[model samples]
Target chain A: MVTEEEIESVSKLVRIKVADHREHIEKVRDMINFFEMLDSAGVEDDELVMDDVPVSRLREDAHESFGGLSGYVREYRDGYVRVPKMD
Target chain B: MNHSSIIRASALEYVRGVTSGEFTAEEFLSETLSRIEEAEARYNAYLHVEDGQKLLARAREIDRGIKSGQKVGLLAGMPVSIKDNICMRGSRTTCGSRMLEGFVAPYDATAVSRLNAEGGIIVAKANMDEFAMGLTTEFSAYGPSRNPWNTGYVPGGSSGGSAVAAAAFECVASLGSDTGGSVRNPASFCSVVGYKPTYGLVSRHGLVSYANSIEQIGPIARTVSDAALVLGVIAGRDEHDDTTADATPATDYLEGIEGGVEGMRVGIVDEMTEGADPEVARAAERAAGNLEAAGASCERVSLDMVGYSVPSYYTITAAEAASNLARYDNLRYGYDLPLDGYEFNSYVAEARGRFGPEVTRRMILGGYVSSAGHAGRYYLKALKVRAKLTREVADAFASSYDILMAPTVPILPFRIGEKTDDPVSLFMVDLNTVTANLTRRPAVSVPYAVSAGGLPIGIQMMADSMQDRTLLRAARALEMRRPPLPEVPD
Candidate 1:
């Protein structure tokens, strides 16, 4: 059985902070239960092969100038894009 | 072709009427606007209708050009509703999501710009599922778009509003984004002609990304010729979208309108015959018979990997959606939460709160599918299966079949609120139509049957990748014998 702590850890890893939510735990339990049922029904890892399509990230060396100004910075200057100032 | 059931009028007819000085462009726009005003309340198809004054001004400009013997597009002065996901400069492109409730696009989608270049008036933005996420428009931040045929029933979605508007003649034609049957399923349910061009055939620039690889902007029209005409305008290479393949030669798609289908090999899928509503299956069979009578040979063909299409479609769509929607964290754009009492991670939480149940369910499912432990098990496996499915379709088309035929949706339009609570059931609603999306093939939904209640049922026909012209050619043949579109009395 997967514990709430384990589920929270997984959720946090995915950037979804749901540790304090009661409904989140229930939903996770449902998912785990579904998987467990599949396991009990003799679904095996051998039957499911993973696809290895590489996650192609933009190359670091390919730095194209953003017209000498980022859209984000432009928005900040225009008071549209907001940010926190140093206290 | 009376007021009701005049859904299949040829665009050529409209052109001839304008050119012959029978009805002015402003007259046509007024009639269309009145029709839209009459239908909008019942169908809830449009997000916002363009100002009648502005539409009249544009139409009058086109009319003046025509009177002066200047060049005009084939669909000049024709009003077209765009799906909300596609950008229209200065129009609110909410993508049916609350996060983008008032977000006006600064620039137009490539398709919108092209349509404008062809003198097509941007009529309005149609409603859709938030981010084009679900088969039913129930996932929309706005309420569900009701079916034009039966107000109590759902107009199939995520392009439901577009399909409804086209079917009801609220506009001459509309643009819809097809991601795993978004356009086709709604077209099927609404009993209109919807075409998804071969993947990347239409540029995706400025279309709000859902599943980047599978989603395509396509045309939904009352007739095949209208779809063909719209496709001609929008289907071309663009500088912004890199994925567009070698440009399919632009042709006057309406030129061969009278061409009879002789010696053409039409394939009917055995897979689509099973688990389908008897009426839908029978409709497909009837369509096949019509093709035979029209001088085309129809044969049953088996696509081996088609049975696995549903799972493969769900996996890939969900995974891509997770990544695409990750940017909506209340940071750069979209709805943001109050800064007071909010933690750093609460932005995501707030964004999640804005997501509908269907959106949340898909996010969770997609997130889980792409998780570290399950990535190899679900996401990757689905891609391999998808590749195999694509190959199966490729091999079949490479063989004797020029096109494959089936019912677009296995079932007819169900009552609104019927399947909303069950996510799995709603997902299964588009089971029959998603295969074309998975395989990156072109497909269309043409009304093949009407129920006793006068609702429209659709028959889907698909062709090989980049063979969009051929599919539209075949659909034009079917359209001649098909039933009239369902519309309200004038």
Candidate 2:
């Protein structure tokens, strides 16, 4: 079971705010308990394959911009996306 | 056709009418726009409906093409709604979250471009669960889309708006993404045809990722043939998305669609049947009976791994989502507020705080499961389970069945806020529909019956990966025998 402290830690790590830590911890614990059913799947010594996609199908390295990056950026100046100042 | 009849017509019928000169594309667009305006106040199906004049102008160009003997493509002038997650050039694609509330897409999703190439007009952007996370559209930042069949009932989602748009005749058809039953759920709820093609069958380029590996952009339409037509337009390889398979040349889905399901093997999944709503179960059984009478042999088949599908699906999707959504950091194209004198990490945290509760919850859970210490225990274990589930489904298809039949949603649509407080109960609604996503198979939902309360129930059928045509063919057979459901009163 996940405690409120763990929930807070996870929330901060994921950059999300948990309004009510107690409620969130309870909910997350319930979800994790449900996910525990995966243990019974009994996958013994099965190698984890990332995906079925063949390497040959990968797109060649090309540099064609989708264009209008400034248009989508929330704050842009001097051909760069503006972010908050780092400490 | 008059305005009412035009709105009621199937996508194929509308296209045929436009091509045959029985009605101009302009006339069809006018009728569809008027229907959208009429339905918008009550249904809230669309986040953005295209400008009336712009749509009519596009339609008029198509009409001129027909007059001049130019080839107007398959969807010729038909109005189609797109789920908000699919980027449409110059349209606001919100994915029903404030995070992207002001974001306008610069390029069309590959599916949207293909739809346009086939002459399908962009009519509107439909609402959806925020980032396609929830089973109910009530999670939408734009507000919930009511089921057209019963205004009091919730529309199963995250494609609820697309389903409602198609069901309420706001558009001839709509496109939606199914990560874990998003498309099929709403289709069942709205009494329309919702199809999720095999993963990688359709290019995922420009679809806002929730869970990339498990999701596909699919079509929701008024009829099986219309859904198949839309699928043919959208399903193909794209140079942009390497995950897509080689392009399959477009074929006439309506051609020989009426071909009966004689000698086909249909298996009713025993695992899906147990613990489902009695009414929903009866509807699935009745659909099986109809198919059997239509010349298919039917029997019950068991896939025990189905019991683990939901947990595995949620874990895998959450983990992927945590990684995929890391791109949104308030510096780029999403919700942002200028905050001076803050560290970069703190600024990102503050901006990401704008994500809604459902998204935040999933992010937290995803972070927990994929964290360094928990990765091996939860994430890897879930992947192993996913692998086992995939093998189990493949084996079932190989041995006993051409298609597996189940209820699209185990329960009928419920009232708003009924299960909002309990997240687990809400996730339980996806029990029957998540198997296809987990196994990367093709599945479709076709309306089978209406409950005594007049709510719609859909029968779900799935085929093996890349067997989209087979699944759609079976759905078409069942669609032919579907009982006439009463239209939502205007």
Candidate 3:
């Protein structure tokens, strides 16, 4: 079972400050729930030979195809793709 | 009016009309801009919408080219919205995260470049879950993208904005990425068609990675034909993306639009149906009956290990995510902390601080799973389980089923904030769709049913790995059987 301290430790290890997740009760509940589900799953390990473990795919080599202004405006602007910055 | 009719009126019909010399490309672009303006206030579907002055200029240019007898691109006049994660050189690809707020891309993703090359107009940037992490657009740093169908509910995400924009006719089609059903879930919830091509079928050169192994750039459209048309513009191999395979040829998916499923074999997954809401199950059954009536053969199939897919996907995705997101640590030009006394700690602290709750939670979980000590027990075991699951699906295909049919989501879209507080419940929402992602297969979510209250549900279609065109063809055929969707209620 996941303990309150264990959840906090894990959360800290991952670098997230769980501001208000003060109660570890639900956290433990989820862990127990997760493992309980897994415990009943009797999975088997088997190997099957399939067509290609790693198959090579051929792609057409083409360049610089722009349909119209709608396409261009949708893609280009700013110094790059615009996204919100974290302050 | 139904979205299909509007599509016919403004997009397809407009194109046909232009061909007949009744109007010009400029006219269609103007109408689309007008529609986007009309719906923008309530839907919150777009992250950014250009004033159309520049787009109109291009439309006029295309119109002049047509009049001058110049050969224009196939989508010469259609306007398309782009999910924010895919880069368009010089535009900010936010990935719906405040961490990268105002982060600009140095270049266009392969798909965006292809769309621009084909003459399709880029209308706007659509909103989504932070880093494409959640099923509901509610996780967006920008705010939740409302369902065009029901503003009270969400447009399924992390491609929620794209789906809503498409469903509400804000754009003819939009580009979205699906890793663990980002595109399909939104499409399902929004009542439109969202298609994820087989893994590696489309180049991922410029898509901001969520889960690199599973993420695929796909299309969201009002109709299957539009989705297929957009896929034609984007699908291919790019040398920059080594994971792209050389196994199959990309076909003109439009050719398969009218090709009825004469003798194709469809597998109805019992696992996908069990525990699904009655409305969702009935929708799948109804679609199956329609296909059978149209000359396709249907059979029930069992995926005994299917239940493990969500957890397995989570395990594997978290591991990969830890590695992929490592770059966001305020370095080399992503969101960076102001370089002060110490760069390293500042960057690390800033990244950890700025990332949303869901993003931070998953990254932490991912790091933990891939940690040296836990690697074997969690990550490695999950990979082994994935291999087994993939093999099982391959065997199922080998047993004669061409595609697996199921409900894209087991339930209708939920109200905003209904389950965001409960991360586990939110994650389980993708249980039915994650299997396709884990197996690296192609799938589509087409609107299947409208509830008594009028919310839209979707039917999912999964094709074997590398059979991207075949899946599109089947979905297009099924699209013909579904009803035209009505306008999303406020």
Candidate 4:
């Protein structure tokens, strides 16, 4: 079972606040226990199949004009997205 | 004309009517809009219906083109609803989350653009589970979409509204995204035809990411041919999505679809049927029997790795989802909380807090599985298991069968809140449908039988990866054999 502290640590790592960490801890524990079923599949010798497209065949990087740039960014000034201060 | 009849017409019928000038596209759009308004109050299928005048204006152009001897595109003003996760330029594409509540998309998803280019009219944005995480529409921030068959029950989700819109005749067809049975589950629950193409067959560009590796935009319609027609339109290589294969586009999915399934080998997945509701299992068996009567050979096929599909599916999806959804950090496109005198982390936390419970749970679990220590033990192991399962399914198809069959869902549609409390129970409902997503194969759900309680049960048919047309042909054969289903009454 996952402890509340572990849930808190995960929440911080994921950058999402858990409203009731205690309630979610038990639910998360139950789900992890369900995931434990994967241990029985015995895949130690299996070779991973890489289905992704090869990088060599990729299209050349080219700029395409999009008219909706203003709609996509929540806050933009002088064609740049504005972000909150970090320090 | 009865507005319901016009809405209930097959997508092909609508296309044919508009292209041949048999009925003005404007008249058809008005009837469809009126039916949507009538059904919206009872079924809650649409999150946002397009303005009737805009849709009618587009339809009027198609009619004028037809009269002017100019060839209109294939779909030619056929009305369709898009699941809200798929971006349509200038429309709010909320994925049923408060995080993107007021966010408007600047560009259309590839499928949306294709549908528009083919003259398919976008009538509404359908509701879904927030971030496509839940099995029932109950997780949607817009509230649950009620099953048209019984307003008290849930329309299965996260494509619940898409299925409901098609089933209730609010649209001639609808588009949905399937990651682990989202399309097929709702299609079964609502008695519509849903098709989940092979993972890369349909481009994923402009779809709000859930699990990048597993999800694909699919089609929902009232009939098998209509689903195939829509699939033909939305599928093929997209320059934007590199994951798409260099395969030939299916230009004639409706052609020769009525050809009977003679000499085709059908496998009834033993593992998928073991613990399914008796009615669901029996319906699958009945479907098999129907296929056999159509001269297809049927047999039991055992896939030992099938049992691991659900766990592997959830693990991979959660990990992918955690990575895919991390971009909604309030800085760019989604709902933002003011950071007045607050730390950057706190602002992000507040913004992400807008996610519903199910999305939060999945995201948290995804983080847990992919974290440093657990990555090797859980995430890596899950990938290995997924690899093994994919190989096993490929081997099964190569040696044993041309197609596999199973119940689309394990049970009938439950009341809205019946399974919401137990998250595992909801995950279990996806047992039969997740394998297709995991294996990256094509699957379609067609309504096979209705329960004594009058709820519809659908049987899922799967074909090897990229064999989507074959699956549709089999579904069409079965659709031809079954008695036509009655329309859900308003």
- Please report the TM-score between candidate 4 and the true structure: 0.97
- Each prediction's Cα RMSD? 4.4, 1.7, 5.6, 1.7
* TM-score per candidate for chain A alone: 0.47, 0.73, 0.40, 0.72
Q: After superposition, how far is residue A64 of candidate 4 from its true place, in Å?
A: 3.3
The weakest ten consecutive residues by lDDT in model 2 chain B span B247-256
Interface RMSD, per-candidate values to 1 decimal:
5.8, 1.8, 7.4, 1.8
- Over the true interface, candidate 2 deviates by an RMSD, in Å, of 1.8
Shift of residue B347 alpha carbon in model 2, Å: 1.4
Give the range where candidate 3 chain B is weakest over 10 consecutive residues by summed lDDT: B2-11
Model 2, B328-433: lDDT tens digits are: 8877666657757778888888878788778877888899998998877788888888888888899989988899999999999999889888888898899889
True contacts kept of 2: 0.72
Q: Give the per-residue lDDT of model 1 (tens digit) for B343-458.
A: 65665665566676656656666777688887766676677677767777888889788989988988888988887655655656666788899888999998777877766788
> Which ranges in model 2 have alpha carbons more than 4 Å from their true place?
A52-54, B1-3, B247-250
Q: Cα deviation in Å at residue A70, candidate 2?
A: 2.4
What local distance difference test score does each model get? Answer: 0.77, 0.87, 0.78, 0.87
The complex in candidate 3 yields a DockQ of 0.15
Write model 4 residue lDDT over B45-155, tens digit each, in one string: 889988788889999998898899876778888889999999998888889988886788878999999999988999999999998999888999989999988999999
- lDDT (tens digit, per residue) of candidate 3 on A59-84: 35557444433332322355454233
Which is the winner by lDDT between candidate 3 and candidate 4? 4
Q: Write the per-residue lDDT of candidate 4 for residues A18-42, one digit (tens) a residue.
A: 7876456668778888888888888
Give per-model TM-scores: 0.88, 0.97, 0.88, 0.97
Chain B TM-score, all predictions listed: 0.96, 0.97, 0.95, 0.98
Clashes of 2: 0
